[model samples]
Target: MSVSSSLTGRTLIVMPAFNEEEAVGNVVREVKKTLPGTVVLVVDDGSRDATSAVAREAGALVATLPFNLGVGGAMRVGFRYALENGFDNVVQVDSDGQHDPAGVPALLEALDSADLVMGARFAGEGDYRVRGPRQWAMKVFATILSRTSRTRLTDTTSGFRASGPRAVALFAEHYPAEYLGDTIEALVIASRSGLVIRQIPVAMRPRAGGVPSHNPFKAAAYLGRASMALVFAFIRPKSIYRTGSNA
Candidate 1:
C-alpha cells in the first residue's frame, strides 16, 4: 500500500544532515518515492558540504542551523517545524543512507497503535553490519533500558522511527541536546509520561561514507552517560501526566 493511503494524517520525514551532501539527494528521492505525499525536511546541522543544496534540489524543505547542533538538536529543530507547521506525524531518519526509505511504511504502520514507533534492526532478517563493540554496547544499553522502563526494546540505538502528535509535542519540549542516546532516552521518557511505544524490525544498510562517528572511547562515554541519564530520568517524578489534561 502507498504511504498516503496508509496514513490518516499528514506525515513529514525529517532528515538530520551533517556533511551528507553525497547521500542527501538520493535519500530524499527514495523517501519521496516510497512515501508519496510525505513532506521531507532536511535539518542541515551546520554542514560544511552542499548537503542543504542537495536536499533542496531533491525536493526537501531545508532548515539550516547556524552551528553544529548535533543529531538531537537537529531533530529538535525538525520537531519544531513539524509541530508549528501542523504535521500530524513526524519520522526521523538519518541522511547517511543507512536507513532504508522503503521501510518507512512499516514504521508508519506501527504508529497507528503507538504514540511512537521505533525501527528495530536486531529483530529481523536484515544485514545489520554494525561494528562488534558498538553492537555489544547497544545490547547492554538496551537491556538496562528495558529493565528500567518496564518495556522490551531490541534496538535502543535505532534512529529510524516515527512519532505522532503527543510525541512531537514531548520532543519539541524536552528532547536531549547531545549524544546518540536519544532513542533510549525518548523511550524512557515516553514510558514515564505514559505514551505508548512500539518497535518493528527494519533493514539497516551499511553506511555509505565517512567513519562512523562512534569510537571505543566515545562509546564508553556514551554508555556511561546514557546509563546515568536513564537512571535519573526514571527516578525523577514526571511533570506531565498521561491524560490530555495537564493537571
Candidate 2:
C-alpha cells in the first residue's frame, strides 16, 4: 500500500500539553492549517489556565487530565484516544510550538517504511543546538539508543515523532510515565518491542513561550535523571501486541 494510503483519514496529531495556554491555541491552529481536516487532540495535562478553552476555540479536540501526568502520561492518553477512535497513525507534537507543524508531513511520510519515526534535530537540519551537560547526556543516550535500536538516531530526546499502527497499539498498552520516559525510554520500549524505528532531520524552533526546561543550572539534574531513564528502560521487559489490525 502507498504511504499516503496509510495516512488518509487515519492520522492523528496528539499534543500533550501542560500549562501552555499561550502557545497551545496557536499550535492547534497551525496544525489544522497545515493539515486540513486532520484531527488535533490536545491532551491538557492539568493546566491551571484556560488551555482547554483556547484549544477548543482553535479547532482542536481537548482531553483534560485531572492532574499533571507529565508528557508520558498525557501521550498514553493520546495513543489510547487514537486506538479508540480508529486512527491508525499517531504523531506527537509539542504544545510549546518548538516542533514545527510543517515538518509533520515528512515524519508521517516516513511511516511508509517504519513503524516509528522520530524527528531528529541534530541531523544537519536545524541550527537548534544544546550545550553543557544536557548536550553531553543527549549525545551519550543517542549513541546508545542508535546501537540498541540498530539504527543511527541523533536526537533521542526529541519530542517530535510519529507512530504507525503497531506502535500506537503497543504504546497505548505499554508506554512509560516516568520522567524522561516519554522521549528516551519510549524509544527503548519501541526498539525492544521489535518495532522498526527511523529518524529524519528536522529544524526545531525556540519555544514560542514558557520557561525553558534545559539550562546550565539544570544540566546536572538532567544528566542524573537521563541516566536513570536508561537504566529503567533496560530493566523493563518488552512485549508484542497482536490484538488485531491496529496491532
Candidate 3:
C-alpha cells in the first residue's frame, strides 16, 4: 500500500537516534520515500555527533534532548509530539538502518484492524539474520510474555512497530522512562486494555555500522530484567487505559 492511499489520517515516523549520524539521513530519506505524506521526527538522544543536523537536513523534524535519554525516553518524547500534534498514527524505526523502510507498507496494512502493528523478524517470511544467542533469547522472552499476558506475541523485542492514536495516547501517558523494554510493555498493556495487537513479517538487516547496544551478556541481563518487569506489570491491578474523562 502506498502511503498516500493507505493513510488518510496523519502519520508520523519517529526515529529515536543516538550517535547515528552515519545512517540517520539515509534512514530518514528512505522513510520519506516509503511514506510520502508522513512526517518524520528524529529524537536526538543527546548524541555528541551530527545526528540531529543530518536528520534536519534530510527533512525530518528534530527533537533534541539536552542529555542522553535512553530509547524509551526518546520514544516518549516522540509519542508526546505525535499526541500533541494530533497525528493519527506513529511508526518507529531504528536509525541504525537495521529496519527496512520498504516493509513499512506491510505494517500500515496490518494497522487496518490492530491498535498496534509489530514487525516480527522471526515470524515473517523474510531474510532475517540475528546472532544465534540473541535470537534464542528473544524467542524465550516472547514465550514467557505470551503466557503471562494470555496473548500470543511473536516478537516482543522488535523495535519496528506502528501505533494508532489510542496507542499513541497510551504511550504518551504511561511509557517506561528507561531502557528499550517498551516494546513488550506496550503489547502487554494493549492486551490488558482490550486493544488489538497484530504482527507482520518484515525483512531486517544486520546493524550497518557500530555493534548493537547490547552484547551477549548484556542482552541476557536485559532479557531477565525485562521479564521480571513484565511480570510485575501484569500482576499489578491497574489498567493502563484511562477512564472516560481522561480518555
lDDT of 3 by residue, 14-103 (tens): 899989998889889987877777789999999999999999999999999999878889998998999999898888999989998888
Worst 10 residues of 3 by lDDT: 238-247
Candidate 2 worst ten-residue window by lDDT: 238-247
Model 1 over residues 81-139: C-alpha lDDT tens digits? 88898887889888888898888887877887898888989886596756656667778
Collision count of model 3 = 0
Task: Give one digit per residue, the lDDT tens place, for model 2 in 121-174.
Answer: 999997998888889999999999999999999999999999999999888987
In model 1, pairs of residues that clash are: none
Whole-model lDDT per candidate: 0.80, 0.88, 0.79
The deviation in Å at residue 87 for candidate 2 is 0.2
Per-candidate RMSD, Å: 2.8, 3.1, 2.5
Off by over 4 Å in 3: 5-9, 129-133, 147-151, 240-247
* Model 3: colliding residue pairs: none
TM-score of each: 0.89, 0.93, 0.89
Which segments of candidate 1 are over 4 A away from where they belong?
A: 5-9, 129-133, 235-237, 240-247
Each prediction's number of clashing residue pairs: 0, 0, 0
